[model samples]
Target: NNRPHPEYSLKYNKSRENRLIAESSYNHVITFFEGLMNHREIAIPIKHIDFSIGRICVLEVNRDITQSDIHILKTLAKMMYPLMISDKKFLNLETSRFDYVLSDLMNNPKPNMLLMRKKLSNFKFDLDSNMYLLCLCDLDNINSKSKVNYVKQMVQGIFEKHYVFVFDKNIIVLYNNKNSFDYFKKCKEYEEFLEFIKNYTLSVGVSKLFDGISGIRNAYFESLSAINFANRLNCIYSKEPSINFYDDYVLHDLVYDFVAKKKLHYILDSTIINLLADNNTNLISTVKCYLDCGENLNFISDKLGIHYNTLKYRINKLKTKYFIDLKNPDSLVKLKLAIIALEISKGYDLDLGLN
Candidate 1:
């Protein structure tokens, strides 16, 4: 395909030529393209580089390509192949170092901050600058090492100054913010990452910006918590990839912990418990939908696919029968917390510990 012109094409059987060269016990082949373009082509097979026939060093000249020229090219290719292998080995070694440091930092309950800072300094990371963590929760789904490396490379490309590594079946990215913190720029980079990973069903959880290397452990947990919230709430578990920030779920953090301890129901109003106990799930669903719709009856009716009057009737029944009022702000807050508890409880067992 690398021809001088579209019409000046050669019907060269490259594979047949390679077979002929292999059969002849020769390391190179010299082909004359005089009929096509008065050119001489030399193809030297790089035996020790990759695969069975490694690679080829092709030289096309308008004049003769001699055996001496082939020998020089082969010598250069052979010399360069070791450097290539060395570079790959160096890359793997560097990756393993990063992986080891990250595993120690994340898993150790009391990591030596001074030692960690000194070790990170070797990688040219400034301890005083802002640090951010991004957790790619679906890296486990990517079974190939090459794909994992591609994802790491993509993340590094998006955030120029970043440390990308995999841990516990997830990809953890530590983005170093050397310049002044800019929310818009961070968001743009996140958008670019999402665009690159759109093909995979990945859930990206971003931690809030932290200052100094001391905050790295906290940042790691924050990113993990954001991803956990996304999964617990079923907010962004879908066919498409989603990017969630820790700030977006900061308030939910406390509520999630409170409910996870199975302690939230102790203060739950009797009304919510009775409503949840009702055999008709629509009653509880109607209540949850009402709070979610911002107490707007019309919106609730449309979402629940019920008539406006019928929705009002249900609300009236809630007030009279269950002693619950949707209009009161205090009541609305209670209902919101109750719904959060209900949803989180569903992930455990059907029981909300109301008994």
Candidate 2:
């Protein structure tokens, strides 16, 4: 380290050992140097010039510099600033061009899907051969643009084989399904990646493995849905940083309440839902328990601490009061759908233990 003052020695220590050397008397009689430009300092023989962006040419002298030397250095630094800033902007633009190219190809589909495949092929993405998983990390709290870039690059490096991109302002990472001994092993890897950047309050949605470009669009959509709905479901239960797996949500298209629309709501007749919609409805809970207990009256009765006949009576009330039959399989399926829609609409009865 070249320091104008020797006392400014760069120091680091591990354990209980350290040294501070303050006696390096090597001053510039004839010293060739390269410097601290990135930190915005310019090292010179006599006076250190904090120059601006333009290129500077300094005429060297053997002796200590006078006031004239200081003036010339300041003048050169002032001239350099504009050119350096311009060069930086140009470099950023060039880096961003590649990002834009990948973005357009992934987001906007063209007439020829094969051409898009060709484009990705040229970029060294062998989607056809590898079992790929797509992950979209939602940046809920990180607001700095440079930090966002850094996080994206960090994840990309961690999964070096993956295609990492910032599409729609989310970090999208695509990587291969690794060689794992079991499901637990696979989950550990996923946990490692998420935990590494835990400093940033973000949630990630992961897609199940799929080969090739055919399902790429759907995988991206799946990841987006995961980050959005998973975190929401977690928040509903007072959990932080929800990570949703596409596979965990069976019939994922129907699981998200926001996507259900007015159609599913109408499926659950207004009368039946009203009967079950109270914030502390035992009837609704009994229904989910009944299903979970494999329709065994004894099992649910014991679990709910309800007398078997009493549970039977409440269940039969559907058929007698609303002409809805729980015993009938078709009717049961319809009721389940209706109840799901009802539960979503109200977001009520967390104590019901439906999940």
Candidate 3:
């Protein structure tokens, strides 16, 4: 469209006109405008077209408006609508294939690498380089699809090279490895994202950087393990959104495996069994905190919001009644293992019976 005044600019009023187009109720809106210098009248007709994925507006500028012109424009819009809808469906179909193929590859214990490469060739993914896997878990569990798509968009806005998809109701992001994945943790965008989702109660689990396509399944499990540990530790709901790193949980994986193989009652000693059976959760929490704090009295007191005297009293009660010697290396080890075993039992909903 040509303007009567070539030097005149409508940039200042574009936002207001766009708002008018967006908020209008009708399928099409027409507005009359006079040229800046020529004073010639013009008709600007706009038609908002809807597609499966999103909406777009079709606009035309005409010297005069008539029923025939309106019909022609409406007819053109109607003709273009189905093509746009078809394109959207085709795009969605291609995207769903990516989702399905990735899920299948992740689930298969041993996938055919050649076939995998062929399958994903069209997605233009860089499977040859090292990458980091991230899983975003929605605490609410409802609206999984919508939340996944929203998070995917947000992540793409920040990451330039990545493959993002949804699997098992959680959003999975495959970020091409930078010099260090730790860079993402410190980036301003990540902090802003955490702030953005603070109200959504989301937890993020990130895998260590892994090499190539062969390591994807391992990375997937690593991310899931991070999420598992975060939930077991009650970090999901107790604080702001958490971004758990698998490297941080590698040491704990040994204890996790130990508890996974043995029954909690069989693993815990008589003292811990009796302590748990006593039904004083506060005391149990204090003991866990005491062990976690490495027997630092002041730290334990501060962590539990109890006075030093109260903390000492609780420690004495455990020593006298439960015969737990915090000074003894063997006893301390047993106590620490018992705390973890109990947490696994409770957090993972395993058997809690003493028998």
lDDT of 3 at 39: 34
lDDT of 1 at 266: 64
Q: Report the lDDT tens digits of candidate 2 across residue range 251-321.
A: 43473343244443444555455455443367777777876777788989999999999889888876676
Comparing 1 with 3 on lDDT, the higher-scoring candidate is 3
Give the C-alpha lDDT of model 2. Answer: 0.53
lDDT of every predicted structure (CA atoms):
0.65, 0.53, 0.66
Q: Candidates 1 and 2: which is better by TM-score?
A: 1
* Residue 216's lDDT in candidate 2: 66
Instruction: Name the better of 1 and 2 by lDDT.
Output: 1
Q: Write the per-residue lDDT of candidate 3 for residues 1-355, one digit (tens) a residue.
A: 4433543323212223422343232244443345444332322222223212222333343454567865676566556655755654422422467888898889899999999988888887677887899888866443322234555666667565568777766778888865788777687877776764554457788998998878888999999898888777774236555788999777556566666665555556778778866768878888778778786899889999999999899888889999987778888777777776676666776565655
Highest lDDT: which candidate?
3
Ranking by TM-score: 1, 3, 2
Q: Which ten residues in a row have the lowest lDDT in candidate 3?
A: 42-51
Any idea what lDDT model 3 has? 0.66
Clashes of 3: 0
Model 3 clash pairs? none
lDDT tens digits, residue span 8-72, model 1: 32123223343346322437765655556455556554443122223354656455667787788
User: How displaced is residue 40 in candidate 2, in Å?
Assistant: 20
